[model samples]
Target: MEFAERHDLLNKTFTPRSPVNQRQLFSGRIDQLAKVQRAVESPGTHAVLYGERGVGKTSLANVAEQIAPIWNSETIALKVTCNSNDTYSTIWRRAFSKITFSEKSQSVGFLSETSINTRSFAETLPQELTSDDVENALQRLKKHARLFIIFDEFDRVFQASSTLTLPFSDTIKSLSDNNYDITVLVVGVADFIGDLIAQHESIERAIVQIPMPRMSSVEIGQIIDTGAARLEMAIENPARQQIVKLSQGLPYITHLIALHSFQEAITNNDANVNKGHVSIGIQTALDEWQASIKTDYVKATTSVQKKNIFREVLLACALAEVDEIGYFAAADVRSPLREVTGQSYDIPNFARHLKEFSSENRGKIIERTGQAKRLRYRFNNPLMRTYVIIRGVAEGMIPLEKIR
Candidate 1:
């Protein structure tokens, strides 16, 4: 194959660092897509899509937004990406400005009727806005089309505001209460509504909560099939299974492994990927992702004075059996810690590290789950879990024979 052709195929087929392109080949999440469509069609039924970072929440939202216009011509999909410093007013104003209301010109005569083209209002958003201001803007577009506002990366708002910003919830409540021709679709990293915002009990009734979990092995296989079809290549069953096993239900990890595997195949001028290609792919993925993984580790462990404890704590979690989504409690890590370090340590001893790991913008590598008495923690980035596994073995922190 020519170099440019291979390069183009690689760029289009593998998207680890960015969200899947709207026109690109995508797979799985059929149920989530249907839920979004149903919520969009039902009047006054907004949606809240919450999940881990790389479980394809954004991809589902993006695909839904793209498909909504085709399903309903009147649907106007507006995406507002939140940053750390953005407030409710700032975010809403940016979304409001994208709205353009249109109408068909009405005329009396045949000549006038012939000239009846669609006309739209110019966007004019207020610099300083309030909940009332946003509601009023939605009201003006009532006669035109339905608005589907998608707030992606919404967790950043909470990261910026410890309380999750009450005004934002109030705006949503007010909009729902008034029965505006709008469906606010919130996409974020969270286990429940309370994690995203506070004092918004009123809006809960109007929302359709959809919690996205890890993709099934079958669904993940579809991703491999889709990518293989796109590249006009084949992934051998063993190689495909390796990718799926290592990915742990995260699409980003799948993409990373698939990308390198495909590259390995291309370099060998082979159309089929085997276990050897997959093994090399895994090593390549780890090498490429190590710098960022180390950065997060360094940042997360800086607070611990004893670097050895921090390393052992992280290694323990990585070694623990974390179900499919990489969730492991302190108890789950205890045995692994002792095995790796040849020293005994209790949960309470490293409880501080757990807190730091779950803290936002501090470590922010792991998040707490389950009830109060039985709290379990999962790595916020699935790739980090995979990284820790590889790095531990490479650094001699873990016995190479122990890796599964």
Candidate 2:
């Protein structure tokens, strides 16, 4: 590859954590993006986007903020990220301060000539406030421009103060019902809406809930192709398939794997990434992610027997049907366990391990649902699944052919 080509590709090809800005670079989220646009355009409609960590919830929020205005010319999107210490008053204070209002006119008795004074809602916004105060402030601001306020990491509000949930929920419902020109978009990491906010029946119809799921195989492929195209590089079918399969539906993993593969090929003075480059890329990603995965793995497996059992369980989960990447049933894991361990263990035996893995104070590696006969489970962290896949292959627990 030429120096200019390599430099441009390296600059444009990889972004593991930050949100993608260019529309063509963003991939596989057409539906969610459309929902956000619709909610922004329609009167009295707000949205809440919830999903697992690293599933691109924040990225979608960022992209929506940029494009929502395309559907409505008056829309103005503003976003604020919350921390564990954020409260309703503090968060709203920050939001109001960020709004850039046109300067208000002021006059002096002697010099009645045109004079201007800058002002913002936050200047007079009370420290001790209620939902009504926020609604009133938003109502006044909406006359100038339609608002799209995004509360990224919104779960922090409730985590900091559970009492704020009802107030926040009430404020959202009131703002929506009153037809204020402002639409609030809440983004968080959770399995369900109720987990993030208070379970209020009144909120059921007040907000448009968009649950962001893991990317599909086709979507992951788009990301690979889009990045490779930008870099003026090519990824062989085997290499592309390897990255997507091991990504486990998370876009971050895809970026990490692809970045490593790109760097590996560049080092070798090659433009095409083959399975060999992918294999090395996997090892590199595994090394970079080793510390965190080992910490979680050690926490998940305390006993020798549990450790042995978990190795088999993770390999089985990785080997599950492509459709069932993060989630798999115990029955799905049984066949692989028998293959790996050559020992027949009943569901009852695995049940204890699952319970421990799902416990809050313990492993917290997985979450399970359903009854005894139809139990299902999913990795709480997609990185854990990626770690499992890499470990399985490195340790010879999983065959290379299986992943390819």
Listed per candidate, the RMSD to the true structure in angstroms reads 5.3, 3.5
Residues 242-320, model 2: lDDT tens digits: 8888886788888888888888888888889899998898888777874767888767765655345766765666565
67-88 in candidate 1: lDDT tens per residue?
A: 8898789988878888888887
Clashes of 2: 0
Among the numbered candidates, top TM-score falls to 2
Off by over 4 Å in 1: 1-3, 101-122, 162-164, 195-197, 298-313, 319-327, 334-382, 390-404
List TM-scores for all candidates, in order.
0.80, 0.86
lDDT of 2: 0.78
Q: Which window of ten consecutive residues has the lowest lDDT sum in model 2?
A: 317-326
